[model samples]
Target chain A: MPVLYASLLTLFLILIPGIGIGLFNMKALFGIVVLYGAFLIFISGVIYRVIIWAKSPVPFSIPTVCGQAKSLPWIRQNKIESPHTSWGVIKRMLLEVLFFRSLLRNEKGRLKTGGRLLFYRNLLLWFGGVLFHWSLFIIIIRHLRLFLEPVPSFVEFIYGLDGLFELFTPPLLITDLLILLGIIYLFFRRLFDPQTRYISISTDYFPLMLIFAIVITGLLIRHVQKVDIMGIKAFLIGLFSFNPSLPKESNTIFYIHLFLVATLLSYLPFSKLIHMAGVFFSPTRNLKNSSRMERHINPWDYPVLVHTYEEWEDEFRAAMKDVGLPVEKEN
Target chain B: MVYDKGKVITGLVVFLIILLSPLWYNALSGKVEPSLKLSMPKEEKSCIEERMFMRSNHMDLLIKWRDDAVRKGIRTYKGLDGKVYRISLTGTCLSCHIDKAGFCDRCHGYSGVKTPKCWDCHNIPKEEGSKV
Candidate 1:
């Protein structure tokens, strides 16, 4: 049911701009309105989510400690795993973001035919994550060519390097190949893995299906169903300039690819994908493990009214005398 | 209610800087013109294929021509207009395109595409092609 819904929804999204441009010729609506609206939503939505996360006060220095913390001089501290200082936290965050250290280090449990429990590190998921993220980073950076006028030297250098193989007529870029492989691996992993599939909901497949269509449409425009490169650039430039114009030589496939991209951006902030921003705000990942060395007081802690022993004794002196009991004060 | 106010500001500043880098870079340069125009052939009234087809699918056509000529030992191409043209890049494409810099390099440079390996095999022509 999840698979059917995701695939059907993706097909419907493609047909939207496809039919809009192909039949109705509403280029301006998709080209200008949808694209810019998505951008506005994406930027503001991400910022809002980040700010909302920042508003919540962290009440503890409870960082997840996997190794020896900073203590006695003779005892060595595993700084990266149980960070005590801000600098150590930074290093740990870098390792987590760049390398997916947690995923790589995490162990998976399996049950054998003989009812034996086995524990092992699953590298395929880690490898797939790394592949997908790095490829995405490269692809996004390369796309600066369309957004920036007189493309920067670094962009040009990377572009040349990525297309070094220069195999096909348009050149089969390595990142493109890697990204496709990564996405396919991710989709099948989710489908085949028992634990993952059991926990998976419909929304998980939505992004995968949408991105798959987007990538396929992008490949089609570049290699198979070609579009006018010149006109497309002009249209993009106009969008950035806040003066939108529909190109006369536009292709339906290009519009479909673009619509999918816009949809992804718009959906990012509201979905689980907001973790891109939330990662930085994570208490476990970002907090310092200095609970013993420093007091971890709650920010909302406030003072309360109190009664002194002397005041209580003075008030009860008369009552004590009547009852013939000893008192600290004389009447 | 917020914790780490300084860190939050710094994070947001950094995020905005990277996200808006393209806009700022382009705005500072004050150059908005899309400079990917190709110089058309002067004497040739029509290409082997239509102009629109040539604009987008030229690379595929060129590759097919190269394979057909070199690997299959086929040297003739049947144009959509039913004209037979020799499958030679230097003798045919450059005869009209003339200036490689103006006709080819401009688009490639603007798009940040690597200079194709076509020149490794084909002979270099004089700049008079642009003058033509």
Candidate 2:
């Protein structure tokens, strides 16, 4: 039901821009205004979330360590597994952000007929996640061509590597296929996998469907229903340059693509998709496992009124003597 | 109320740099608004297909021509105007847009696309009349 609702919502989003541009003819509203607003929202929203995380004091060095702690110099320390220093934490974070090191722990154990336990990783989730993320990154880098007027030599180099196979005439990028495949795997898993499905909600399905719609619309603009890209590029140049205008050849599919992407951008900060920024702020992942080595102190510690045990005994001694009760001090 | 102001600011600055990289690059290199002007053949009133269709689907059409002429030995294409023309890149296509550098490579460069393998097999068309 969540999947169905999410799909229907995505369908509606796809139509809104298409019809807004195609039928209603509100190009400026959808293209320039809405998109610019979304960009602003995304920038502020991410910063806001990150600042909030920054303010939330991590009162404990509660890092999740998987290996032996550092003790005797004779014994080898698992620096990566249980980072005790800043450098170790940095390396751990790099591995975590780049390779999804933590997600590797996503495994299941099964008992075989021979009474032996087999523990295998849920490889599809990890693989699909990496593929989808990396593909999306490459695709975004590729889109820098539109925003950047004189596309840098490096971007061109990436373009060449992406289209290394030269599948189509203009050179189809493998990332398009990769992202689609990855998202499909992820989506199917969410819908069908018992554990994932039990936890899956509309939020989970929405992003996947929205991303699917974005990619499909982009593909539509490029391949199936081809629009004059030159005009679109010109329009984008104006957009980036602060000299905004709609192109003569501005097509509906393009508006739809832009709408979906901007929608994702705006939705990102508020949605679960904000794990893009949240991962860096995760205390468990980012914290150093040096609790034993160093004294932990709250940075925001403030002066407070306190009644010490001695002070309490001092105040109560006279009363206790009057009542013949036990007192710490005698006068 | 933010703690670790240095790291948070660094992260935000990095994000901003990447976000505005396009604008920064453009500012450094100057905006490349290459108004691509393809010199139409003098005598022809219109191309085999309309201009917009040619602009968008030229690659599609070119590939179709390559497959038809080389693979299937089908050499003639009936235009939308009902005129039959040779399905040839060099002979039919390049004969009109003779300045491959100007007519083809200009937009391709603007779009950050390489001059694809269409020129790998076929000769880079003569640039004598190129006005780009």
Candidate 3:
């Protein structure tokens, strides 16, 4: 019930901006103010989150170790899993960030009818996650052509590579299909799995639905509804260079796509989407597992007033003497 | 399990400031909104395409013109309005839009878009009454 309401709310949020820009011809407002504002929020939000994470003092080396720690020279150590040095930490972080090594190792627990609990590798989730992230990255890079003039050769190279399949007039990009497939798989996984559905919140489903909408609208513009590419480039170039201009005959689908993108940008920092930045500041990933070799003290630890035994003795001296108790000094 | 109130507040404050920087900066500086510097063509009331279509899709038309003229040895285009035009940048486009600086450079310069490679193989026309 909460999920349905949240999904509808998210849909409404995207639809309003999209319809406003598309139908009302509010391209100038959506293109310039909304887009730039979203970018500002994304940048500032990421920086703020990182700063907060950095300021928090980790009083313990709490790296989540999945393998053997570095010890005796003869014994094998998993440097990538149980990092003991900064370099090892960097290597581990690269693998985790780039390949999602941890997620790749994820296992789904299932109880058999005979009362036996078994764990099986869940490769579908890992594949979907990797596919979605990588495709999104490539798509973003490909979009650089719109923002930049005389589009860079590398961008052209990537664009060519993406459309190498060449199934149509404007050749189909493999990443586009992969991203769509990945998002669908993830969305279904959340909806179908009882355990996942039980733990899932509105925030979790909203982004998926939002991204799905974005991609669908984008595909509509590219294939079905053919927008003015020159106009889009001109508008985007003007927007970035601070001299924004709305092109004549703006396509509704293009505006819809742009509005959704803007919404995603603005909502990223406040939502769990900030895991993109949070991953770098995570203690479990960033910290080295060297607590056995070195001690970590809390920097914020302060001295407190303590009632010493000597002070207690002094305060009770008279009473002790009256009672004729044995004393160290005749105070 | 102690929460750092100071860190949290500072983070929120920084986030707000950064997010609102563009608005505040623009307001304080009193910067005027920028406009594209599109110049009117001399001796031509209309282009090969509709005015609105030309504004947004001139590049596509130009690219098609270039490819047709160079690769297919076709130099004429039958426009949407049923008017045929010779596909030559220097011969057709620059002939009307004589002042490249005032006409082409206007929006391109304002938007920081790079000039097309049309000039690589052709001579740039001099301004009227100016010796090359």
TM-score of candidate 1 on Cα atoms, chains taken together: 0.92
lDDT of 2 by residue, B42-81 (tens): 7777889988899888889988988898999999999988
Compared with the true structure, what per-residue lDDT tens digits does model 1 show for residues A1-331?
7888889999899999989999998988888899889988998999899889989887777688799999999999998899998899999999998899999776789899899999998899999988888998898898888777777889988887888888887887788889889989999888999888988877888888887888888889888889877677767877887777776666889889999999999999999888888889899999889988888888877886777877887888888789998877686
TM-score of chain B of each: 0.83, 0.84, 0.71
Model 3 residue B126 lDDT score: 87
Candidate 1 scores a chain A TM-score of: 0.93
TM-scores of the models, in the given order? 0.92, 0.91, 0.72
What is the TM-score (0 to 1) of chain A in model 2?
0.91
Interface root mean square deviation for model 1, in Å?
A: 1.8
Writing each residue's lDDT as its tens digit, candidate 1 over B1-132 gives 666889888988898888877678778877667445578788888999998888788898999999999999999999989999999998888889977887888767767776688877776567443222
| Position B51, candidate 1: lDDT | 83
lDDT of 3 by residue, B13-81 (tens): 775674454344445544323434466775789888887767555766777887799899998988777
- Candidate 3's clash total is 0
The C-alpha RMSD of each candidate to the native structure, in angstroms, is: 2.8, 3.2, 7.2
Clashing pairs in 3: none
Candidate closest to the true structure, highest lDDT? 2
Q: Candidate 1, overall lDDT?
A: 0.85
